[model samples]
Target chain A: MTGSRRQRVAKAVFLHAAALVVVFLMAFPLYGLLLTSLQPESVIRSRELSIIPQTLYFEHFRAVLAEGHIVPLRRALVNSTTVSALTAVLCLLVGLPAAYALSRLRVPGRNVILGALVSVYFLPTTIFLIPMFVLLVRWGIDDTVFSLVLAYTGFILPFVIWILKTFIDRLPLQIEEAARIDGCSHWQVMIRIVLPMARPGVLAAFVFAFILSWVEFLTPLIFTSSLRMTTVALGMFRSTIDIQVGQQAAAAVLTLLPVALLMLVCQRLITQVLMSGADK
Target chain B: MQAVPDSPAIGGQDEWTRAPGTLRRRETAFSLSLVAPALILVAGIYLYPAVYTLILSFARFDMAALEIGRWVGLGNYKALFANAAFVDAIWRTIYFGLLIAVGATVSGFLIALLLNEEFYGRTLLRVVVVLPWAVPPVVAGVLWGQMFHADVGFVNALLFRIGLIENYRIWFGDGRTALHIIALAEVWKAIPFMVLFMLAGLQSLPPQLHEAAAVDGATAWQRFRHIVFPLMLPIIIPLMLIQFVWAMKAFDTIFVLTRGGPAGQTTTLNYFVYVEGFQSFDMGRASAAAYSLLVVTLGVVLMVTVLRRYAALRKATA
Candidate 1:
């Protein structure tokens, strides 16, 4: 018995060691970037990259702030937050009902419509990018945050609808029926019974929508032409592409912050979505 | 995992049990109202322009053609198919996509298999695994670009020290290496998402099958081959399909890293569309190429669906 117990412990140790190696491999790139953010340009240029830079200091962060990263970041944070929050809110407003209809109320051709909606997004976003640019230009909303919001709402709505449908499918229709029997109006029953039950899913939908838009790169890239108008993600990209090394590294860190925080806060919920299965 | 919002004990009991009266009609109207805004939004923003892209493809809609909106009747598509560069771009897109699909599947399988074990520091390991999934694709590109840059590159330095090379190998300089390097970055960025789906599938698996197989003197490989793989197909198939499409559409990593450089060797269909339409102002041809990409995606999806159905049918019969 003791001999097998030793083998069991050995197996556990081996498992842990292998897992640690994987964790290190996965985390190493970002950690390397963080270390790069601290190093001076000269040391960074020496071509001897280490886990921790030899001449590490806080100067890069200071330099990044001194450059235009801080101001644009402020605007971008506000812009990203507002657009994402609004996207989430708009998605919820429109998505909840569609989801409810699909899940509960017998809307004719609902399955076909839902399937079509999903398949539409499966086509490359580029399929829409060119025409969208033309459309937005004609509408005169090009280079504006409103256009970004509308574009994001359109893109994220289907995902929100899909997720909300999953949630609403799992919800009890009897409560809503009970509310209807109790003389509550349809919208009222939705608000009072179904919506209350779906709060967590709604929040998950909102948070994920926010994160996706917050980190969105391409739409903002073409849609918003100017630096002043673009997102933090765009700023980070420009900082890197333009070879603003110190600022680029710093901006990389800044770009990661909101997403990291969101993941930290919402990972449990996110994993639940993952755990539930990706089929629908 | 967040508790699933309380489900009523009643199974599949729906809201239509009341009556087939005027009240039901009112409910239908309300439900239709509820779904109308989404339909409108989808139709206006998504559906409209997609069809417009079809129109724009067929018509001469370049700067000069923008004025006339003249119909060209397969002129753009003919040009696209005739262009060797565009045709080549199609092959490059599939090459990169297959690389990513295979990489993501293998690494995701490994990570899932590892995490499925009862290991110490499991939560911490999970966080580390998921860290990349949280990264903005742009940031991931930038970060990896820094590591792979010719001078001051970590890849070169480490490779040299480990005796993998005698000199610094410029990872992104050669056309041959650049595309694969970019694909590698994409694979790294994609691992977390793949692992998430895989872990979900892995966790849902029943361990009793493995235990019983082991007791029957089956080797580990046999058990996995004969049991785990078949049971895991439902989850892995959808995840891999999604991964294929995503990798095909992926633009950020390669764009940031190479911008389809070294004589446009790394350019894919997605990039082809962006450059042709936005950069070159050849709206008509770009639209044609974009539609071709869409067609390829649809064709793949259709093929895979049929294949999976056939496999399932065969298995059932067997």
Candidate 2:
């Protein structure tokens, strides 16, 4: 008993230690990134080997927020937020029933539609990379925020639907059945029964789509050129070459701030999304 | 002639409709109506690009260079085959994919195994572990770029301080190390996702099996090898394949980090298409290159999947 007890304690120590190392490796670069954001560019350029910042600075953040900079951080924030929010709303509006139907309907060609939907995931974005530019240019929406939003919503639809459909499929069909027996119409069954039970799923899909959009680069990179509709992603990329290290790091921080906060708030739902997607 | 079976699938029991014998038709209409928005969006965004690829691949369009389309079918494909840069880009893409897939999957497996235990701060660590995943690719790339900077970069400073090297070595300079660093950043971005998938697989495995194996005098390694390995293979294989697909097609990280630079060391097939179309304005050749890449990627994925299935069959027979 004593030997087993000692071994169990040893195992626990190893587990905790391993977790610490994993956390450190994952968080160190990000910590260094945030460190640069908090410090002046001069200190970073001094080549000192300090991982922690000695003094906190806000000038870089200010410069990013300043009106006349090339990146235009404020416009970018608004543009990114608008695109992300609109993408989320648009995806949910379109994805809810597409997911529902895929999960629960007996429609003809169900498999074909579902199979086609997976094209985005399986194929390289480059297949559409060149052609999409031409297509968008031809559509006369090139370089507009609308073009970015439209492309992102479409790009993220397949994953969003897969997640939401998994959520909806897990719902007990008995209540839906009971609603029908109680003289409920199809709309009532969905609106009253499915919708009520699908709040968490809806939130999950929304947040997932929102994050995917917020982080998306290809659409903004290819879709928008001018600074008027620049996302922080594009701004961050542009800043890499044009801006100082501290300011670019600050931009990275600002871009990641909301995503990190949302992850904390939607921790369980996000985990559920990943796990559910994995299960399928 | 055959009666349709009543389905609780969707569209409530057919009672409020006038068409008594049109149950299938009604269900189809209702499903189609519900899915109309998505269909339209997908059609607009997905179908158009896909269909347009076919036409553009055949026609010559370098309008920016004052060239016009001549509808030379197969000419673009022939040119693509002869293009060394395109071939190099494809190989580089595969090389990057292989490295990232192996690195992320292995690290993810270890982390998932570690996290599967009952421990303190498990939930907190789970959230922290997924922080990298939540990071947007371009930002993540930039964060890494900051780390890899030669003058003030933390990577060099840390290595020098630790006496790993005589001086700070450029992490992203030469063509050789550029792709490796890109792979490293990608591994950082991808590990969380792979961990999530592996954790799901881990949690789904019944603890009873492990317990029974333990009580039957199996060592830990033996128990894992005989029980966990086979069960986890399915999950691991598919997740790894997905990771491979993402790494093979990934552009933003490479674009932001090196822009396929240091003499085009990191120029993936995706990057090649981007340059040809946007930089050179050769939409025809770019389209052809992209189409070829798509076929090869799909073919590789299918081949791997079939090979895995075959191996599984052979092991069972043996």
Evaluated on CA atoms against the true complex, candidate 2 attains a DockQ of: 0.56
Clashing pairs in 2: none
Model 1 misplaced stretches (Cα beyond 4 Å): A1-10, A53-56, A67-71, A238-241, A277-280, B1-19, B64-68, B309-318
The complex in candidate 1 yields a DockQ of 0.51
Estimate, for each residue in B244-289, the C-alpha lDDT of model 1 and write its tens digit: 8998898888778888988889899998998998789788888899
Write candidate 1's Cα lDDT for A1-280 as tens digits.
9998998999898898889789777888888788788887777777554665566678866765553653366667677788888888999999999887777775767767877778876788887887888877777789998999889888889888888888877777677767666667667777888898988788888888888888888889889877678687876554334745655777788888888888889888877764553643
A256 Cα displacement, candidate 1 (Å) = 1.7
Query: Model 2: per-residue lDDT, tens digit, B1-318?
Result: 111233643334455454654756766688788888898998887788777877889999856443346898999999887878778887888888888988999999999988788899988788778889878888789888988888788778878888887977777779878888889999999998888878888999999999999899999899889999889998888788888888877888889888889888889888888888777788888888888878777777898899998998999999
Candidate 1 chain B weakest ten by summed lDDT:
B1-10
> What is candidate 2's lDDT per residue for A51-130, written digit by digit as tens?
65678999999999999787788889999899999999999888988877777666667767777887678777766656
User: Candidate 2: where are CA atoms >4 Å away?
Assistant: A1-10, A239-241, B1-19, B62-68
Model 2 root mean square deviation, Cα atoms = 3.1
Give the clash count for model 1. Answer: 0
